[model samples]
Target: MTASRPHELVEDPEYFRDVLNSMRMIADKNLRRVRFGLTGDGIAPHYEITVPDGDYMEHSVRFPINGLTHHTHHQSPEPFEVTNLTEKFSWDDVIGMLERALSRKRERK
Candidate 1:
């Protein structure tokens, strides 16, 4: 898991929605499915973009609940890697990270 010094309290509903919206835009452009929702009494939120590789294979870029860091999880034969953001980041940063991870996966195909 990746760890970073929390910069903002994204637990707020409005902020969370905005973040998800921004991520959805990226997912739409990249042909990925965005899955996100609030968890744990509506305090923590989690978002993920899953990119399908084939009929039965896929990979995901996830921002886990309560964690500001981003990580990539691939299917068998690939390993998970976490990236820690040490500075304040916006939704663009997250989207860029996801795009980069997806690009790398494509190269491996």
Candidate 2:
């Protein structure tokens, strides 16, 4: 049998733009007080969704790209939780996680 060729991965700017657009659509549909954009350097990017609880308290879900992995951080008064989603990541996964964290913050308020 002939050996199969390795799949090629292309880093097209259009593809990146499409991905960002999809995330923006998700944020527009479901999230409030959202702030999202590529970092100035274009080497690392991040998006944050915040739910303000009070003057001093807030719940935040942050997605930051580190190397080749996508890392998530949930910040709150209880404790900081970090998750790496590079293995099996999807837009739905990110959205769901944010929703859960926001819900918990709302419940506590």
Q: Name the best candidate (by TM-score).
A: 1
lDDT of 1 by residue, 1-109 (tens): 2123222223333434444454554444444344443232223333444444554346544333222333332221232223322322445565554455456557767
List candidate 1 segments past 4 Å from native: 1-13, 21-30, 37-39, 55-109
Tens digits of per-residue lDDT for model 2, 10-97 = 1223333333343553344334333333223333333333443444346444433221232343332332223311222345554554
Which segments of model 2 are wrong by more than 4 Å? 1-86
All candidates: CA RMSD (Å)? 14.9, 16.9
TM-score of 2: 0.26
Which residue pairs clash within candidate 2? none
- For model 1 the TM-score comes to 0.29
Record all residue pairs in model 1 with backbone atoms less than 3 Å apart, i.e. clashing.
Answer: none
lDDT of each: 0.39, 0.35
TM-score of each: 0.29, 0.26
